[model samples]
Target: MEWGRCSEKELKDLEAIVGAENLSTGESALGLVSRDESYYTPKIPPQVVVMPASAEEISAILKIANPRRIPVTARGAGTSIEGNPVPLFGGIVVDMQRFDSIIEIRPEDFITVVEAGVGYKDLNKALGRHGLFFPPDPGAAATIGGMIGNNASGVRTIKYGATKDYVLRMTVVLANGKIMEIGSLATKSSSGYDLARLFVGSEGTLGIVTQATLRLAGIPAHHSAAVATFPTLQAAAQAVFDIMRWGFSPTALEVLTADLVQMLNRDRGLGLREEHTLFLEFQGASEIALEEELGAVQDLCQEAGALSFQPGLGIDERNKLWEARYETYESIKHTHPGADPFVADVAVPISRYPEILEYTAEIIRDHGVTGYPFGHAGDGNLHVVFMGDASDEEEWGRIVRANEAIVSRALELGGTCTGEHGVGIGKQPFMEREHGASLGLMREIKSLLDPQGILNPGKVFP
Candidate 1:
């Protein structure tokens, strides 16, 4: 598809809609929105960047761009690991930063209305006062809009679920500059199509979310954490499968390779055991219940050949432990300075968790690549960050091959190419393999919603 260049008249019209201050054709602004946290290089910079403060402003901007076939990519905090927010066609990028506002918090109703650009941490900090919080952690300080676009989830997803589960309603600005609101506040709906959910993981390909009403979860009355070390990565992975199989529900269950643990220790002063480890957290209403659950988990880990089981951490220690876990990606990056990360995010059935972990290890070993394999093990999600200098074609070729091998194995094991990270550019090759004929239906929906193909052009479809 040929994309139109933003002429001076179009630029002035957009500026008039959002004011000169909110719109920019500056090189720095275009550069900032041109790329995300992904390793993908920015090939073409956007022609203009506009920070639309309200839904109406976004609608007006879309109205101007949609008819002209100018690509409009919505950007939030720009923290996506995949290039989900990258403007590949070099048109107009709608920066959602100005939409950061917590509209309302109805604690009694267990819901919060917020603009798309509110930071995840900032929203939770405000919710903590009311004994409530949003569950999809996603690690980074990502904006609500970005999370919705990618359906982002993190360690907490094992129990609470992803961003899609929490999203109830959203005010979206469609490609034709029409303001559309989808979803209901009711807990259960027997109503028509679930359009709200349709847009949740669309990655701004369908529409741009300006505001969202999310379902809030109450804070647990009690919390407990434990650390279990195993002699092998497979052992820890097996324990994760067993814990899930035997009906042990953990708030967060993470498995880390020894190399990753060492990196965390060196980078964050964590001082954790430099062995394959499983980090587990349980939330309950009573201390006795938590103790019983921890004891059962210990037995499962022991049966899987655990070297040590340390349970019952204090609040301070628990906070510190999770903080370290949340910074795993950063820790890996810091360990290999000047190297880019090619992260493989895949998920399989719980029973196939151990097999995938073992297979990933073999691929890394055979390729002789520096890879840190770790992830939300309880949910059968595996992440391996292959670090290498992108400029070195031979070395990076090995990394690419290793990634492909792992993803192919995951597909063979009834898994997906990406568990959390959306398909921006990196995983586009696997979309057909993973989705099969259903992918054709997805394309149909995209075409129906965005006939002009102006919304987030050159993404999702292979």
Candidate 2:
């Protein structure tokens, strides 16, 4: 779709609504907000960025933008790997950082009301005071609203479930400038329509999530962690399945390959090599509960032919170990100096995970390039880092070929092109291959919610 230029009238009107200081058309500023951490290269800069301080202001901006046919992409921490923040058509970027506020906490209800810009670290910090916690922790300090928007689930998803599971209510600003309240504070409800779920993973294509009421969990009194080592990648993956099948539930279940382990060992002095690792975290109210869980896990690892299994670090040690998991992007980039990498999120059934990983490894090996394979193994989501070789065009071509091979294998095994990362522009072309006719339904839904094609245009449905 050809992008229409921003009219003088629209710019002036937007400037009036957001004030001159909050609006910017400068090249550098627009370029910064025009794209995110996705692989898609920067294209045309957004016409301007408008930082609205409140949901009311957002509604006003949307009301004006809809009539003028201006594209408005909502941006959080700019950590989206699917190019969701990239403005394919020159439009307005709504900076949501100013909306950061932890509005209220209901300890009895186990729900917290927060604005769209409240970061995960801050939310947990506040919740900690009340002996509660939010579990939908996507890496990168993603905002609560953003997590709900993308239905993000992190390492703890093995037990806590995804963002959609914890969301109880929300205040969403739709594309047509309408403020719609979906769901209720009640834990269970048979509402007229499940609109909350629609916007949860809509990726801002449906509406701008301005506020949300998310469920929280009581802080466990006792917790235990373990780092299990295996002789091979397959062994580690098998250990995850075996441990899960034995009725043990850990708050977090992660699988790291030898390459990633070596990287961690060298960069962070983890000394975890010669074995694929499973970093497990168990939460309970008593030492016995934690010990029993870990004990079961240790036996399961042994049954799965683990090279060795040991208890996780103390509180301080566990925090340091998990910190490395959050720095995966930087670690992978460091692996191949001078090479830019695009990460892909692919998830398949647990039974097919080993095959998928083997296929991905073969593709990367055939290309004669290095890539990191790691993700939440308990959920079967894998991250394949595709490092681009700047010096050789032929090598770059091989990397693209490898990506296609990996994605195709995932689709064949009932996996998706994306697991948690939304399909921004990076995976648009594969929508047909992944969803086939369902792509039409998605487009139809987009049209129904945003007929003018103004809200996050050129995303999801291609």
Candidate 3:
């Protein structure tokens, strides 16, 4: 649907609601707002951008836009790779950057209250003082609102869970300019509806999150990191399956391919083994207990054909050891300049993890595409990145085919097309396949919440 663009009068009214300096229609600002990290091409810049500092301001802006049937997309730092924040239809883009403020940090309650624009790094800094943290580390630049919107999670998810699990309550502005407060700070609730969860991963289509109350975890007293090398990806995946089934929980368990390791060493000068490696971390009651757990994991790895086990016990060592996993995307881009990169993640049952990896490897090999396969193995989620020259349209098609094959197989194995990253436009094809008839119910809910369909149009669905 073609959304109506904001006219001079509408833009002026938006400026009135959030000040002239807080609103922009400039080409440069629009250009920056038009694109995200997604592969979807030729940015569709918004007609205007409004930076609201509060939910009331957002409601005012929406009140103006809703009547005119203008598309309003909520965005934070625009770090979403799924094109979640990109304005596909030109209209008003709600920039939530000014809404950043740590409203409260209740150490005793193990909850934090922050505005939508609060970034993960800043939240972590505040939580550090209290020796607590929001465990779901989605990405470096993700905001709390963005994380909650996408229900983002990462390696830390092995033990804690996703952004959805930590989101206790949120202040949301519905599509029709009505504000609604959902959820409670209570440890558990038998309330009317778990409304907070409905919007957690809605990708901003349902509502604009203005504030969030997140559940935090205490910093482990004893922590250690390790990397166990294996001759093959199959063996590493096997070890991961065994470790998870053995009732041992890892703070983070990552699987990196040999090629990715080589690229990391060449680009970052981290001399990691150029073989499939299982990166593991332990956190527990005491140093002695942590060591014992590590030993048990070491035994499992050895049984699964681990080549060597290396430990990173100190602070610096632990950080550096995990750096290899963190530097993956940059390494891929650096090693092959001008290659268009497409990253996709899928999660499966722990038992099927190894077969899926092996099958994905075959698909990449058959297509002759440079694929980087890595991710949180403990959670049975894997991310594979395919890179090829931008000018090579045929290779792009090949990559798309690879994505289709992997996602389809993942579904067949009772897995999701996206493990952490929310479905923006890229994964829309598999939505029906994954959710089946439930897709209709989801659409109904979206319609009920956003009757005019003005909020974040052209997302989470075709």
Candidate 4:
């Protein structure tokens, strides 16, 4: 389907709805919203960038765009690495930054009402006051809306969950200027179709979320962190699988490769052992309970052939370690000055975690490319960042082939093309192979919700 262009009259209509100051067609403004943190580039630049402060304003803008068939791409903090928010068709890019507002925090109910543009760290800071937090740590300065768009989850997901688990309700603006609320404020519901969940990871192809009510988790009274080194990546992965299989509940379980550990040591002055390592964090209600659990974990790691197991890190040391872990992507990028990273995010069953890691290492070695493998190992998620020069088609081709091989292996192991990152341009090709016949139903749902297909035109579908 051909998308309508943003004409001068349509631009005037948008400015009238959002005011001239809230709208911009400037070169810098268009450039800013044209792409996200992904390696993909936009096919064309957006004609205008509009920052709407309310659902009503967004409704008005969508009203004008829907009839005209102008593509509307909703953007949050622009932190997604999958090109989830790129304005590929280039019509009106709706910037949601101005909608930042923490409306309400009901500590008793373990719920919080917030506007879509609020940052993840900002909300956590406020929630910390009440001994509660929204526990889908995506490790980026991402907006709540963007997190919901991708259904993001990080290391903590092994114990807590992803953004989709915490989202109770959302106020969304559908195509053609319809403002509707989805989901329930109650804890559980056997209600109709789960429209709230449908919109959570839709990547704004179905609707634009304006506000949300999220479920929160309480802060644990006691927490402990440890690092376990292994002789090989497979050994570390086996330990992770065994720990989870034996009913060990860790708050965060991350695995870093030897090369990645070396990079972290050089970049962050960590001075860590440059070997395959596992960073583990456990939280509980009492110190004694945590200590007991750590002791068991150490025994399990040793049984799995751990080279060394160091447990019981202090608060400051744990914080510094996590800070460096969160900066893994940046550290890799910094190490390779002018190279672009092609990240492959995949997940499989816990039993197959070790096999996938070994397969990934082999694929990287066979392709003759620099790859960093790491991720939330407890949940069987693996992220391999392949660094290369984008302009060098030959070298980048090898990286692409290696990524495809890894994803194919994950799918064969009963996994998914993307564990947390959404199906933006990067993983579109694997949608059919991953979903099979169900992909057609998804496209039908997309068409049903957006007949004109003006919302995030080139996304989700292949």
Single out the weakest 10-residue window by summed lDDT for candidate 2. Answer: 36-45
In the range 219-324, model 2's lDDT, one tens digit per residue, is 9998788899887778778888887777778888888878788887777777664467888889988998788778878988888888887794699878888888
107-167 in candidate 1: lDDT tens per residue? 9999999999999899999999999999999998899999999999999999999999999
Q: How many backbone clashes does candidate 2 have?
A: 2
| Model 3 ranges with Cα > 4 A deviation | 41-44
Better of 2 and 4 by lDDT: 4
Question: What tens digits encode model 3's per-residue C-alpha lDDT throughout 27-135?
Answer: 9988888877876633456788888898999999989888889999998888787788888887888988998899999999999999999998899999999999888
> Cα RMSD (Å) between model 1 and the true structure?
1.0
Provide the global lDDT of candidate 2 against the true structure.
0.83
For each candidate, the alpha-carbon lDDT, in order, equals 0.92, 0.83, 0.88, 0.93
Pairs that collide in candidate 1 are none
> For candidate 1, what is the TM-score?
0.98
TM-score of each: 0.98, 0.96, 0.98, 0.99
Cα displacement (angstroms), candidate 3, residue 9, comes to 0.8
The all-Cα superposition gives candidate 4 an RMSD in Å to the true structure of 0.8
Model 1 collision count: 0
RMSD of every prediction: 1.0, 1.7, 1.2, 0.8
Residue 220 of model 4: what lDDT? 94
